[model samples]
Target: MKKKTLLEELRSGTAPPFIRELAGEENMDPADLVDAMLRGEVVVPYNLCRKISRPCAIGAGTRVKVNANIGTSSDYTGIEEELAKLRAAVEAGADTVMDLSTGGPLDRVREAIVAKSPLPVGSVPIYQAAVRAQEEKGSIVDMTAEDMFRAIEDHCASGVDFITVHCGVTTRVLEALKNNPRVADIVSRGGAFLAGWIIHNGEENPLYENFDRLLEIARRYEVTLSLGDGLRPGCIEDASDAAQVAELVELGRLVKRCREAGVQCMVEGPGHVPLHEVEANVR
Candidate 1:
């Protein structure tokens, strides 16, 4: 039989020690934390494979988390510099760290960061997939769905506690962007990769179309899914537009599915809104 996910354990009254510890950190009762987890209001991102030295709980009734992104770019690629950034983030009291390295032996960089990070390590698996496609097939659009899923599995197996997946970048959302253009359209790297793949292939976003497969792999590692807003505005001018909201609407739908699967999930969106629009947007 397969092992139970943190969600299942919470339901069974057998949540892990780290999860219980998270409640104490939040100044919440263990039962209360369990209740929040059941209600999908709280998420403790703890992967079974990698024991997090500094575990964290994100969501309602908890402190706002700071997830610092540390990684190498195509121009600047090295493990030591990235590791120094990791140390800096931890020292600065970051709640989590995401390895967004798009350069220098992606696998090695990710694995090294995971081994060294005390905070829960997160990553954008699509980066490696897109990079691999560009190197091997000469274009990001050449990356197969199998290659994409494989990268996700590899990251989870490497003990990444969470991942940012741009599942909300759908063909419809892309269409919305076409109808309603932005001054700085699709600034997110992962988001742009998926968008390009969808338009070039004339197919649906694989992440959205094959979310179940992604969920299964996530369940196996018990990694939290950060459902990213692919069409999130890049500037104040593009803020809160129809294209952005359309992606959020799709993400809201996916959030329900994530909960139903007993997989911990977070919705990352609606950023870059105007100061005045923030109030209404949050409302």
Candidate 2:
């Protein structure tokens, strides 16, 4: 029999130990926190595979959390440097850290970071899939859906606390982008990868199509899914465009799926926003 997750505990009207601690940290009643979590208004992004000593909650009534992105690029693949950044980010009060490395022994780097990070660790597996495609198959477009799913599974098995998946970038969202063009078509890397793959393959986004497989992997490891904002506005002018809204609608549906699957999730938003638009974006 599978063990009940933190979410399952809440669903059963009980607060997990970590939730109790987090509620106390937030000065919120544990029952209130559990209720908010049940309503999909809050997320506790911790993985059962990796026992997080420094657990924290994100979403309603929690302090504004900070997640520092640290990783090696293809151009500058320094594992040590990335580690230094991870240390600095944690020291500087980053609530979490994401490993977005696209270069130099990616697996080794990820393992090192996960081993060292006291805070929750997140990743974008699509980056690894794309990079592997480029290295092995000679093109990013050559990567198969299997490749992508395999990468996601690998990350989960590696005890990645959470992952960003661009499951909202669907064929319909692509059409929306075509019908209502923006200054920047798609600014997110994972979004671009899926968009390009969909265009090349003449199919729906694999992440969207195979979301159940994703849910299965996440459920096994208790990995939180950070549904990537593939159609996120790149520029101030592109904010709140139809394509963006379309993807957001898709994400809303995915959120419901996550909740039903008893998998934790949070939505990632636009890369850039104007000062006035920040409030609207958050809303």
Candidate 3:
């Protein structure tokens, strides 16, 4: 039998002939299904480097994918333990892995897991930057912007496939945050550090002000950027407040710029959102 193109499936109101044949079945119209598939709104996020056994599309006309986050924190685990969690997550069908490790030997931990991961590995470069800064300089704000960029470069060199950069936390947002009243002010460690650094140094955030440089680095490594939501509401009461929405608006614009530069980007969502507000938060 001849294989049916997407166009052919659209004209009929049933499954494509190929799908029917694959199931050793018949009676399904190929045209309608083919039309649906050819709408061109679907996206499959499989990187050439990631050998996905059951790859799926992510955009319109596909099932929603959920990601599981697992990493070592300063107070609790070690690399070995984190790796065990990583293995378990993959076995449990996590689409990707984000290393939020803030303890022990950072680089060694990241490298070991990256080497072991078959799926795309992601990290918040800011976390490692702060961790190293506290170790060497005793305070995160004491670390220069150059140090942060260097940490980002190192992570890219170490084969991290994607990184979360909080480039939306601009000086303007910091200024607004200073005046905004919220219960969980500055819940994000990276956001708080950048805001304080800007206030203390009287300078703009390096990530926000120097985003082009960040894009260049990402382009060089072919690494995707998960634009971190620095000002994400920490609690339900604070959700969609001016400061949080301000950061999100900025991030949306930045996403366009990143796409234009051929650097793959996705927006990181909020944390601590109440179950009732989850849909609104995502929207």
Candidate 4:
């Protein structure tokens, strides 16, 4: 392939075909558009391995994308049911999918979905470790740091292109949580588990303590890390509390670290933030 350029497409009168087709009009030169796409200012997120009919960009100049989460829950659904939901989300125009399956044969379910999915697949490895602990041991708090890291490695080895790590939940933040009074504290399952474990074990979160190791795994697989907001408010009242801010600050530091280490990272923000605070939360 001579590698189609924006200029060539424009010269051929087929530049930005999708955009023009949608607008029912055309104006831009193909070569100029190709130049834009080549710059990091625009991105075509489609993995060459995943054949996408309607490709999209996800960077500086692209439209904001929405991700739909679909997965099996312990009480109600199974793999087959979740797979149906995955297809439904894609059909409904979801830009991405995250398998937040905390129940029902986690590995088997993840593998089946990833193998079948044409779009990128994401996951939270902590959920798998917690589930495994409950099944194999007695409690999530009993899960070893090694157990958690192993699960992360397993997910990467299985071809998960992205992962959410609640590395912001540090021992100091957990201590702050004990002192802070809020309406709904620690809403994230992974966060709650790590908080409980830290309180019980009287140690720092392994994810935070061993972030370099986590980065190593991610760098090896080129997996993007969605740094989870473990202390994200569960209710409007708890929004942007001390614990939350503390975690956010820690995540910012980690983000820089990941960037320095050549690993991709994005911070996950609040869960129950008020509508008014959304912009500030993003900023």
Question: Scored by Cα lDDT, where does model 3 land?
Answer: 0.71
Window of ten residues with lowest summed lDDT in model 3: 22-31
Error of 2 at 173 (Å): 0.4
Candidate 2 — which residues are off by over 4 angstroms?
A: 273-283
Tens-digit lDDT track for model 3 on 1-283? 5333222333345443343332222232433223323443322223333343433333343345656677777786588888898899889987677788888788988888887886677888888888788899898888788988998998888877778888989887776777788898878877887887888788889998889999878776656777888898888788878788789889988877775665567777877777877676565
lDDT of 1 at 161: 93
Error of 1 at 35 (Å): 1.6
Per-residue lDDT of candidate 4, residues 61-165 (tens digit): 345777879888889558888889889988888877889998888888888877777667789999999989888899989999999999999888777767889
**Span of ten consecutive residues with least summed lDDT in model 2:** 274-283
User: How much is the lDDT of residue 62 in candidate 3?
Assistant: 39
TM-score per candidate, in order?
Answer: 0.96, 0.96, 0.78, 0.81
Tens digits of per-residue lDDT, candidate 2, 167-258, equal 99999999999999888778899999999999999988888998898998899898999999999998888888889888888998999999
Which residue runs of candidate 4 sit more than 4 Å off their true CA positions? Answer: 1-60
Checking candidate 1 for backbone clashes, the offending pairs are none
Summarize candidate 1's per-residue lDDT along 217-237 as a digit string, tens digits.
989989999888788789999
| Sliding window of 10 residues with minimal summed lDDT for model 4 | 40-49
Query: By TM-score, how accurate is candidate 1?
Result: 0.96
For candidate 1, the per-residue lDDT at 107 reads 94
Candidate 1 local Cα displacement, residue 278, angstroms: 3.5
